[model samples]
Target chain A: MITTAHQKIGTPSITTLSETIDNETSRSRIPGNTGIWVGIFCVLVEFLMLFSVYFIARIHNPEAFLNSPDKLLTIAGTTITLFLLSSGYCMVKAINAIRSDQSKTAFRWVNLAIILGFAYPIVKYFELSWYAQHGINVKGGIFFGTYYYLTLNHLVHVTWGLMGLIFVSYRTVKGGYTSESYSGLEAAALYWHTTDILWIVLFTFFYILR
Target chain B: MIGSAEKTWFILMGLTILGAVVGEAGNVGWPLTLSVVALIYIKSSIVIDHYMEMRSANQRIRNVLRLFIILVPMLVILSFAWGEEIRRFTTLS
Candidate 1:
């Protein structure tokens, strides 16, 4: 019997077949088209707009913006940094629990994530209170104004992040995530991570960058 | 991977506290300020790439976002330089 080499050459090559298989496997692995990408895009845009505002404000009033009280910034920074990162870490545990089909453990960690996030706004409120006492209202000089503006904007983001966590926690309690359909947990993790990461940026920019 | 990002966060936090201490130990002045800016750039990159998990993105996508990030600081630094020039020229006038 003649070998089918001639027919094989006429057919799509093995390399092409293997390439198709590889593509499908990679898609199955990550499933990037999930709405998590949209979350990432929103976060990227939000921060960029924020930095742009800072840039324009500084440009418009170079001299008047000096004299930041680093002490107030550091207090807020440290508190937020600790909790946001802790939340991210806790969220990883939650994701793992969901992946392993441990709903109770997943729910526990998700709650922890929410609690950590809830702490953020409280810390921010204390810092804002201190600023108010110091005559650093939202409409103060350029420095104080930007100080309040940037931080309050970030506070709003934290609020939104808290809402996301709360929703995720509710869903986890409702059996929305599992080893079989773990994308919800993955999506929530992505949001938690974004919040954590954005906080780091704010910490550095507001507290460290001077 | 998550653990690695967590470790990075710890390091960034440590550096932040250290920056605070340095700011407090003395005047925290321009040198410390410059150091903080550099540190912010480094830490923010880590956040964007690792925690945001954009490290594995397409290079073009990474570069575009990187450009945006880089430009902000550059503009900020330039403002200082231009501000100085404006002051000097006004004094001369």
Candidate 2:
């Protein structure tokens, strides 16, 4: 194991050391941090609740839902999906690199992830701008309202993931995490992956399942 | 050689493109809608098993996450097929 700063403290008593080892071992059983999973679980539930609303709206106004996607920019949605997926792949690479104690490689991978993550909002900006130019605001109808609500809600989550990625990338470069001590980096990666999966669902709802 | 993550990413990319192509139509029928749902389910499973590494996790957490992903797409398919009746049942009016 690489001697990271977290492990550089004065040698502790056998009890604490054994407990720490056990803790790390237990942590691997689930992967990532517990708090992140809690947050992810909540986010998943929230999205399901939103989809329930989608189901309701589609039930009553199936016509509106059917007519809406054609007016929107499929290119924008596709681009954003690409960005999110590419970024998620980079994150996975970062986690793998860090697990092997390759800090510099991990740093590059995470930085790449950050770049791709930021690409999402830039595309979203132009897409929303196009909507504005075309008079497709939230008040257009039930479909537009739901579209704006859910997409923006997803944007908020992406923003959060981007922030986490930035922080993790910074720390990862400085060797803040190693094979056995990467809870923070892993947590951020997990969170970003969660956001990616949610956005995939959102993309399917808004752009795919006309 | 490509690792699991890269392989997963490639599959997601292909599926996303496929979904985009499917969505380009003006009005999709139940067949396409269910097809998209299947894509969503497969993509979700890949993320859970590969990216999140949840297969080796505890039984309960794994089940909950898997169940949520499975259930939502199922609901979407159901609503797609039986929209009118479901609407009548859920609404107050």
> Over the stretch A91-151, how does candidate 1's per-residue lDDT look in tens digits?
7778768878999899998899888888888887787788778776767677667767777
Predicted complexes: DockQ each: 0.27, 0.52
- Give per-residue CA lDDT, model 2, range A1-210, as digits (tens): 467644655446566899888766654576677898899899999999998888898888988988887888999999999999899899989989999999999999999999999999999999999999999999999999999989899999999999999999889877799998998998898889889888888898888787
- What candidate 1 gets wrong by more than 4 Å, as runs, is A1-34, B1-9, B22-30, B56-72, B80-93
For each candidate in turn, the interface RMSD (Å) is 4.7, 2.8
- Interface DockQ of candidate 1: 0.27
Off by over 4 Å in 2: A1-28
| lDDT for residue B92 in candidate 2, whole number 0-100 | 100
lDDT of 2 at A182: 96
lDDT, each prediction: 0.67, 0.87
Candidate 2: residue pairs that collide? none
- The TM-score of candidate 2 is 0.89
Per-residue lDDT over B1-93 for candidate 1, one digit per residue giving the tens place of the 0 to 100 score: 556746876776676577566544544346755665576567667655765455654455456556656765565566555756644544534
Error of 1 at A135 (Å): 2.5
Per-model fnat list = 0.27, 0.70
